[model samples]
Target: MKFYCSIHEIKKTKTVLVGVPYDGTSTYRPGSRFAPQAIREASYGIESYSPYQDKDLRDIRFYDIGDIPLSYGDKELNLKLIEAFIIKLIMKGKKTLALGGEHLITYPLIKAYAKKYKEFAIVQLDAHSDLIDSYRGESLSHATVMRRCSEIVGFENLYQLGIRSMVEEDKLLPHRDVNMGLFDLSKAEEFLKRIGDKPIYLTVDLDVLDPSIFPGTGTPEPGGITYKEILSFLKLLRQKKIIGADVVELSPHYDPTGVSSVVAASIVREILLIMGN
Candidate 1:
């Protein structure tokens, strides 16, 4: 209730970090609920100094606000709860960052934020489009996160990155608002030529990395991008109006070496450093 990683005694900081350990839809590999804990533990290994940035995100005020406890497998209730949490944080004038459960969490997040900002948009970094009508018959499945974000959330624009895998069916989806298939930064560079600029909410799914590089997620796509490539695009996005961001779908059970958690934490740190500045 007070602060995330309670022992750190971090309170009254600008960064309000919260964990949403709700991975009920991870049919392939459950355990994203544990990602927050593992990432937090690995955060101890991270340093504020970075060759990638002139300053650390902590140079500004940042603190983990704590996690939302829910494991009942109720997607509807979970969405409502997430919406309320974010709305409350905005009411408090706190900038919130939610940790992983699954990508589905982004739908409710975008919907809730759109109620506040009429000009909201999203910068999605992932291996899949996540714009399906539904995955396995659920409206809030991880595969369909962006679809719900577009249909229900009402964002003005969306720019996706690192998309290397998708069924042909996903390519023919109804919502055309999402600017899709902008994979690595190199590919995204050519893709961004047409992407222009907008106020953005960032959502990251770690499976975007090639399994050889980081094989820790609910799903792994082999032809995905690299950390360097993903970071390049995010670094460029640092100049835009990035309202908030979430790192999703990082199932820690698969990462016994904890390499993925370190990467997730690094991404948060870098984004906050570059954009949150």
Candidate 2:
């Protein structure tokens, strides 16, 4: 099913939503491949209007192009497919919003963004600093996705926020633009100033939210930013130009109440409002 408030006519909208349901590299939990449809189903439970932004989805036209077809066990081919699909959308000047199976999808999305915009910055909101050189002999895992993206778009342009977990090796990485343990508004402001007019690719891993409030992800980290706090941060980000974005890692079964999926849908609504504006 299409996301609530989405239209079927692709040519009529400036924003496009695509789902990548390939969680082949999820080392911890494997159900993220079901996230896209789950989020879509949950989207119907919320209102299209955003009281925080004073914007409504009804005012903006966007198309949800369903999930990308992926091979179950083929990581390399799937990444290539995602990259190629996104590159075509970028070339068409469509602002893309991706719904992910895992954070590893960000690597290909960033790669596609790099091909279109030479100067852009990545604003990552996650509970973990996914900067490992490699994880369990796999270089393209969700744990190492951002590391791969950093290689494509220099580390200087990558801004990571709300990171509460990381290894010793991650601590040694250069351009370590991370705010550990909490979301720092001052650091965010500084990065905004540095980004200036450059387009931003926002990647939000749902696990970034406190497990007390959101516990549907494979890796549930405690002591994360609250929902109100995250909404405030998104409101703050409204002033900047967001070229593309994604909301990843919501495994519905992990939370029997289905509240986590609704939470994800709410965040997607706000991000869509910002992108459409």
Lowest summed lDDT across 10 adjacent residues in model 1 is found at 1-10
> Cα deviation of 260 in candidate 1 (Å)?
1.3
Distance (Å) between predicted and true CA of 154, model 1?
Answer: 4.8
Check candidate 1 and list the clashing pairs. Answer: 4-64, 162-183
Give the Å error, residue 105, model 1: 0.9
Clashing pairs in 2: none
lDDT of model number 1: 0.73
Cα lDDT listed for each candidate: 0.73, 0.86
- 17-109 in candidate 1: lDDT tens per residue? 788888888878888888888778877788866667667554566667668877477878998998888887766665667888888888778
Give the Cα-based TM-score of candidate 1 against the true structure: 0.89
**Superposed model 2: Cα runs more than 4 Å off:** 1-8, 177-186
The parts of candidate 1 lying over 4 Å away from their true place are: 1-12, 153-156, 174-178, 187-197
